[model samples]
Target chain A: MATMTIAKAITSGLRAVLADDPKTLIMGEDIGKLGGVYRVTEGLQAEFGADRVVDTPLAESGILGTAIGLSFRGYRPICEIQFDGFVFPAFNQITTQLAKIRSRSSGMLSAPVVIRIPYGGGIGSIEHHSESPEALFAHTAGLRIITPSNPHDAYWMTQQAVACQDPVIIFEPKRRYWLKGEVDTESAGRDAFSAQVVREGTDVTIVAYGPLVPVALAAAEAAQEDGNSVEVIDLRSISPIDFDTVTASVEKTGRLIVTHEAPTFGGIGGEIAARVAERAFLSMEAPVLRVGGFHMPYPLAKVEEQYLPDIDRLLEALDRSLAY
Target chain B: MGAEHLPASEFDIEELEQSLVTSDPADAPPLVQLMAPDGSLREDTKYGHYAAHLDGEALRAMYRDMALVRRFDQEATALQRQGQLLLWPPLLGQEAAQIGSGTALQAQDYVFPTYREHGVALTRGLELSKVLRLFRGVSNGGWDPRESNFHLYTLVLAAQSLHAVGYAMGVQRDGDDAVTVAYFGDGASSEGDVHESMVFAASNQSPVVFFCQNNHWAISVPTEVQSRIPLSNRASGYGFPGVRVDGNDVVAVHAVTRWALERARSGKGPVLIEAFTYRMSAHTTADDPTKYRELAEEEKWRERDPLLRLERYLRSTNTAGQDFFDQIAAEADKLAASTRADVLAMEAPDFEDHFANVYAEPHPLIREELEWHRQYQAGFAEETAGQAEGEAR
Candidate 1:
């Protein structure tokens, strides 16, 4: 058990995985000597040496492509894509090679690779820094995408992603990287792929992932002031989504509000809304609503907050759900 | 004279001949010729070393693989015309280049391919229906790479090259004898990934083979724009031996690939083999070759067709009679029909499949999303039911 920020928790988790498995390696640009731009991989290279903690060239595609090849050769490589927007250059390798290699191999080989990217808006970053491309990866078959909203999950899920046989895309909310929590290092509880109920309520179910999970929790806290109990669910896994928890909460609440920083059209929120309408239609007292980014490229830094789903946007969606 | 300014010395031909088939190091540049197009033996060369490896039946099998792959290429073009597929990249004349290098790989060796290597995919044992699904927009990749030791088909040009080099590095780290072969077109030779792959492979001595099929075009761009010198000459700058082979010659491709593989396995390092072939069709079904290149260029390549060259060589040697040719043709037709049937029979993937394999362990957000989707779906069903009840009432 330890109290730490999400950044520290992730580093600790990486250290533990490296210690446990000899084959586990961490490779990324600036990860070796610079300890990553966010320092999530701080001190890992010095502790593990350059062989295990590699500082590769400034090539995202090369990092991921190599990681796939390494995974094929029985080494579990955890690749860091540096930033959310930077991951697109490697998207071809991820979608075409890493994701499909498993099923395309028809169970003959398991990729066992983890691609870590710092995602979402709110940091007042430049263009291409706060985009959400989770829907793209989630839509692709044979890939497992997970994002941790807190320190506890950041610690546990990082290890779980490293251990999983399939290639896992672990999206860490860059904005929430500093958020602190108490993490039980010994017990990761359920696998990192399942969703976690962060707050218990009965009035409405709020679903959010990555950075939006913390925003949803804040909204739940604020909603308590109005005496409207909000159930908040942190979506740990984006693909192979844990629907059981979501449906159970929706069944109890009778209303749902899904939130994400990505565009609403064909977003993971859309997928959730359609699924809920199919399975929990009779239990719904109000129509499911979504709070998401607009159908535009993630805007420049100045107006990014407006482009991202914040507590206010989530609360607004909650109010809409209540009206429905 | 400065070391750099020295004229490139002519390679010793005698040394090249002695080490042509054997893995021994000769003073010559790597064995660049094992079988000439004329079917006549190189008198000064040690052709006996590769004689046992080439059989009449095997040559015919290579020919059949090329013909069948070309037929599928034609069918895919037709399907795209009929709106069955959104796009198709045809490998009409580069059959021998793909099949030869593909067959050269051992069971353990891995392959990294670009999108146009459908012939390579067939040789790697991928199902035809699975390959079609990618173009049909049903899936991003239709088959597994680990089963055949073949990576997924990359659409982005030359991206797979870096992956191959990285995988080759892993092979070195694991102390494995397996080498990785990266298949890319001449246009990809100009991409940054290809250069990075060569540099990394050279620096690390990663066991990789760069198999460049110089089919003369990258969409609208010609080969000259991509390279001023021959593509093989580019490898010398990367600190590895490079060879040019008649890409249309299956026997030559096999020999060169086998030699490169042997060198890589023996820890001799990487090699680049440029298969100088031609693309008989458009780059993809969406492309129009007539808009860019002249008809004469196409006609000239047609005369040196890879399939015809092999057929002529086999016939001149009495290795393939009419009966053998007919049998192969029948087999190829059956393969095409079976492939079509498989494509038609492929089941539409289930909706839940989208949520199933994102991670080895269950993710909380994914669980929530999946549950949310179920509820969302159920709501629609309920609405439908209520509407039906209202109508009945």
Candidate 2:
């Protein structure tokens, strides 16, 4: 076991996997010499060599398309999309080719390719650098989406995504990259789709994922001070959500609030709310409330805080759900 | 005077024939041809070595593959017209391009084909009937690429070119000599995906071949609309070799593709092959060619029919007896009958199967959706019960 930042844990996990598997390859722009903008892939190119940690051309479509082909050749390619906003260039390949290849081939072939995208807001970064595109992938079929909140989950979830036969998109919360936690190097920490109840309480359940996890925890602590017991759930897997866990929690609490940095309209929170309503409708004390960014393009740094869901916003949603 | 007011000149058959193959007359790139339209064997010194392996046996086999593929393509079009299939993309005039380039590859080599490579699928040994499953709307992917090392047909324009480059890169890293080839149309050359793939292939020196069948049309748009210059010439800008072959001539196509694959396999990097053929049929079964193209232009391409050229060569060489030609015709018929039977026999997949393989692992969303579907299906039970009661009354 080692204590490391979420970024280091991910690097360690990727290193462990790349060292273990000869077929696994790392490819992206600036991933080789620069070791990634966040330095998560630092020291890896030195260890793995250029063949393993490849610095691709400045084209996202080329990166993903080629990764799909490499997957056909039985190579597990880990493609790094430099930023969340830049993933749109490869959207056609990711959605049409990588996502559909397995089902299209009737399961004879699978693209065990992991597309790593550093997503979400709160870093006060420039436009296109800080945007949450999870809902886009989560809404898409034939894609497995996962996001980890802490180092332990980050380290393990990455390996799990690589092990997955289908195309897995890892939406790493860029703002949470420096958050440190204990990660087990001896084994994988948890399943990719399982949601963890980070904080346990009774009155209401606040579900969050990626960067919003810290906000959820802070909101839970604030709610405790306000004399309301609010449970916080980290949705590790955004696609095949751990609805059983969420349903159980919502049933016990009889209230739920889903939060994220993505737009409130047609976001993943809406899907979670709908699913929870379907499964635990009678148990709900009120309509599932959501706390997220407004329905607009992610604003620039100066007003990003107001656009993003913070502890105040989470608590407000929680208080509303509980008051019902 | 305007051409509409002036009397037309008497059309000369020989002049028209000369014009079709001449670069100056059509303002098109000169096509690399091995066998002339008259079936006479003429050698091009540059590409002769690649075709050295094409003996009588190889020629006969290529002819057989092309014949059967054409028959199967016709049957699929008929099926679509009969409402059995949702749609069909006919690989009508470019048989030589598909069969020759497809057959030239070694077993270890892989192909990424666009939606219209029916002949390539046949050459690669996928069931001719299985190819119709996608058009029939029963399967998401028509056949397993693993079985033949020919990937599923990509409907998205030029997407497969990137995949092919990537696969070729993989082959290079593995220290293997296998090549990867992607097949797309002339119009697909305009896609950014193709440009990116070429750039990546050139930079990495990836072992890939971009095989573009310039069949002269992309639905209603002509090939000229896609590129002002020859599509092959674009490869030079990408820093790679490019060759324009007579797509209607199977012998030349096989030789050219072999040469490109050799370059790629030997780690010389990617090559672009422009197969100058024409689309003899409509873009697909659903299209109206009469609205977009001229009958006179269609007649010009018909005179240079790929199958007729091959048949002429076989006869002029005395390589195939009349009985051999008869056997090929019989085989094509048998293929059509069997393919039609297989297509007719194919049942629609269970509705639940749609939700089954969305994820390799069982997904809760899929499960929830499947369950909801089950209840929705159960909603029809009361109607059946009421019908039974009415009968009893």
Candidate 3:
């Protein structure tokens, strides 16, 4: 085991995947000598040479389109979109081409491509940089969306995403990049799709993912003051959400509160709330609640605190669940 | 140029801007022609020898390929009219552009084609009946691309251009001499992905050939809307050679495509070949060219039909006799008849295949959904059986 930040863990994970398979390559803008905007790929080009770790021209569509071609040629290319909002330029390629090619080919071809985007907001960044657009991709089928909240998952899930034959979008919580944790490089404790239970409780279940896992844990800890035991489940995968795990937890806790940094309407939390309600209806103690951003755009950095769902919001939701 | 932003005293910005805005096809690169539209062979110093090795048998085979695919296209259109196919994209006049470039490719070369390359699919040894499965509504894709080195047809215009460049980059990395050919049309050339494809191919020096069949129309809109200049000239802006060929001339297209493929495979970077042709039919079964084009314009292009030109050249050179033409016609009819049978006999795949292969790895949700679907289907079967027993009672 080694102690490192989520950013370093992802870097290490990329390095390990490159070393594991010679066919694997890394491509993005400013990812070579300048190391990436966040320095996640620092020193990689020097190690892997310019061919494997390419610093591509500043076009998101070109990066993804060529990566799809590379995948067709048997190259496992891991593409990095510099930020969350910038992914829209490549959205057509991702949702239409990359996601549909597998079914379109009728099992003849599979693109083992991994797209990594540092998503979610909490660092007081600018407008486009600080947006969690995971819900947009989650709605598309044939895509696997995974986000790792800690260094351990960041390391293992990054490798898992590269190994996956289906095109995967790794929504790395940009806000948790500096959060340090121990990662056992030798063994992956779980698969990339399963929702993990970080805290054990019997009163109410709090479901979160990506940047919100830490917030949920903090909320669970604060709930002890009210003598309300809360269980926190980190939803690792967004597309094929592990409803079984969440449903199991909901069956036990009987009350569920799903939260995220994305908008509450038409968000991942809404899907989770609906599914848990359907699957565990008889065991319910209260209607499933959701706490997330508002319907409007990610607001100006000054008022983002009020816009983001904080621990107070989770506690309030928890209070509503207990009241019910 | 950076000099455009300079002061007037330093640079003639107004003159340069005027020259840049002015686009005349006559000013574009000279068109490559080895065969005149009247079926006369012309001698060219550069590309004439590329077709010099083709003996009488090879010329006859090329004629047979074009004739057969044209017949197959007609049959498919007939099937669509009969309601056997959902839709069919006819490659009526662009046969030479497809077969000539497609046959020029070596077995190792890969092809990325737009949806109307049935002739190219033939050159790749893909079963023509399989192509009908897509139109028959039985499959989205009907063949294994790995078997033919020909990717499934891309319908979203010009999207496959970048994929072709990237595959060529992979070939470069693998130290292979095979060139990847991307087939699009004049209308698709206007897409940004095509521009980026050229930039990436040029930047990486990837072995790729951009084969654009200027079929004159993108559905209702004419090629003029896509480019004010000849589509071939766009390659010059990206630092590569671009050649405009008489798309109706098979010999010229084959020769030019061969030259471009050789140049790319030899690491001379990418080349763009614009095959100037016309769409003799609607864009697809859904389109009506009469709404946007004139019968006089269609008649003018009919005089330069690719199949007729090839046949004239064959007869003038005594490369094929009347017996050979009759034999090829009989063979084409037989093949078309068999294809109709095969398409009619094609079956809808089992439901299991539908849920399968969406992901290579087993997905829990897919597994659960498949199971639920099985149970749902079983409920219907049980309901019918129970009703049958009630009738017996």
- Best candidate per DockQ, number? 3
Best by lDDT: 3
* Residue ranges of candidate 1 with Cα displaced over 4 Å: A103-109, A223-228, A263-266, A277-324, B1-36, B40-107, B113-163, B187-196, B199-203, B217-221, B225-229, B236-241, B249-255, B280-299, B302-393
lDDT of 3 by residue, A1-324 (tens): 999999999999999999999999999999999889999999999999888899887888889999999999999999999999999988988988899898888888998899999988878988899899999998887999999999999999999999999999999999899999999988999999889999999999999999999999999999987788999999999978999889999899999999999998998988888877778899999999999999999999888999888999999999998998
Report the lDDT tens digits of candidate 2 across residue range A87-195: 9999999999888877777777888899999998888888899999888888789999999999999999999899888899999999999999988778764689899
How well is each residue in B364-388 modelled by candidate 1, as lDDT tens digits? 5557779989999999999999999
Among residues 3 or more apart in sequence or in different chains, the pairs in candidate 3 whose N, CA or C atoms overlap within 3 Å are: none
Query: Of 1 and 3, which scores higher on DockQ?
Result: 3
- The local distance difference test score of each candidate is 0.82, 0.88, 0.91
Q: Sort by TM-score, best first.
A: 3, 2, 1
Error of 2 at B388 (Å): 4.1
lDDT of 3 by residue, B277-367 (tens): 9999999999998899999999999999999998988898888889999999999999899999998898888878878877888888789
lDDT of 1 at A253: 98
lDDT per residue, candidate 1, A58-107, as tens digits? 77777887787777677899999888889987887888777765554434
The DockQ-based CAPRI class assigned to model 2 is acceptable
Model 2 alpha-carbon miss at residue B117, Å: 1.1
Worst 10 residues of 3 chain A by lDDT: A269-278
